[model samples]
Target: MEELLAQIERALRIGLTVVVAYLVALWLASIWWTFRDIRGRTTDIFLQIAATLLVAVFSFPGLLIYVILRPPKTLAQLYEESLEEEAFLQGIQVHNSCPVCKQRVEGDFIFCPWCQTRLKRTCVRCDRPLMLRWKMCPFCAQAVYTPGSGEAQPQVAGGQTSAIPQLRGADPEDTGPGTRPQIAARR
Candidate 1:
């Protein structure tokens, strides 16, 4: 009976030592990780603490649960998510205006149904949606307009006319200069 008791006491001592070592290691690791990145969420910290405690107490099963339930986002993932959200918010339509005809158009329109004009264009630099008559792409400063097409005029480089000029109005000869004909703006 004495021998059995001594063996049990020895086992208990070893188990306690292991548990203490595990806890100390976990605490130190958590502290180190917390300071490394301030942007980590509260849920992440809580999960880490829970995972550490469970791992120390129950070993393999606890680790399996932690792995399965923990968030998949790394610092890079968090940054990407924020960037995507910002882009989405920025692109949200506050108002719709036709680029080609300079008319008010519906935001959901793929093309200007009235004039059969393509309202969207790819920016040369960023490849984002650019207005067909855009003098300079809002997202990328690429010239998208052409003269004589009633498109918005792009700013001349060095104030020179070397680049294609954007058309501001219909040809002067089409309506004789002396006619003084009434003109209606598209939008």
Candidate 2:
């Protein structure tokens, strides 16, 4: 009977030792997990050390408390969220853009401010801006005239002719004295 009791006590000691070792290993694992999780969520060194120590001292219960107080989103997730919000705000704001330079422009601008590309032509009769592709003015029923045509050209501000001068046949009547040729000089 005495020998049997001694064997039982020894078995109990072995089991107790295994349980203690397992608990210690679990406590260490919790500390490591808390440290890694806090590091991903924050950049502060003090917070990471505090979180690791909390888990190491109080084990699973401290880990639960840390989880409740920790930031919900990681640093990477916060950055991505901010980027998405910025893109959404940019999409919401509408801009009138120039086709040639893709720069922001006003609705009534005749030329792109950035590239100086001609956007519209002034109607000779009504002085309204007209699209290049339109055959006739929508505001006024006058027919639209394109450049290089022999018809009467449109006049711009300061009494300057807006059309590229007709160069097909030289008309002596068209080119009076002290006037340059109708040809466009290349740069």
Candidate 3:
């Protein structure tokens, strides 16, 4: 009977040893996994080493801490998000652009060169640049007229034609011999 009792005790001791060994193996694997994960997430080698040691030294609790506090995104995910934000900003700039022909114009241009679409026009009375479709000039209390409305003329200066609207009768024959032409203002 004593011999049977001793055998039973030995079996129990071996089972307990196996269970402890399994737990130790699990702890070591968790540490290794933590090292691998942190390495993949960061370019810093010191961070990887520190994370590995932190989990390894504390056994199970350190792994719990790492799991709770690790970065939500991978390095690739962060880079993708940055690229998406840049693309979104570029889209906004494109949306605010004016060139009707999709050509880029420099610095406050009144008309597009390719499509000839009037981007902005100068107020006839005030000579201030105003956007198209304004009913009245904001700078001066003058009636807004469309560029091609048969009453507005291109005022020229020093061999350069200005986009300043001039409320004049349509004179197709008179391209104007000089810089500016004094013409009759039609109603």
Task: Give the number of the best model, judged by TM-score.
Answer: 2
lDDT of 1 by residue, 31-145 (tens): 4543343235434666556656765565656556655665666667788898866544433243465544556677655456666665554443355765444566565334444
Best by lDDT: 2
Model 2 lDDT tens row, 1-187? 9999999999999999999999999988888899999999999999999998989888899999999999999999999999866654442123456665668777677777797766667765467876666656577544454655322333433133223222322552343321323223331
> How close to the true structure is residue 117 of candidate 3, measured as C-alpha lDDT?
61
Question: Of the candidates numbered 1 and 3, which has the greater TM-score value?
Answer: 3
Which stretches of candidate 2 lie above 4 Å from their native place? 92-187
Instruction: Name the regions of candidate 3 deviating beyond 4 angstroms.
Output: 92-187
lDDT of 2: 0.68
| Clash pairs detected, candidate 3 | none
RMSD to the hidden true structure, all candidates: 15.4, 16.8, 14.4
Task: Give the lDDT of residue 104 in candidate 2.
Answer: 79
Query: All candidates' TM-scores?
Result: 0.29, 0.49, 0.48
lDDT of 3 at 158: 11
lDDT of candidate 3 vs native?
Answer: 0.63
Model 1 residue 90 distance off true place after TM-score fit, in angstroms: 9.8
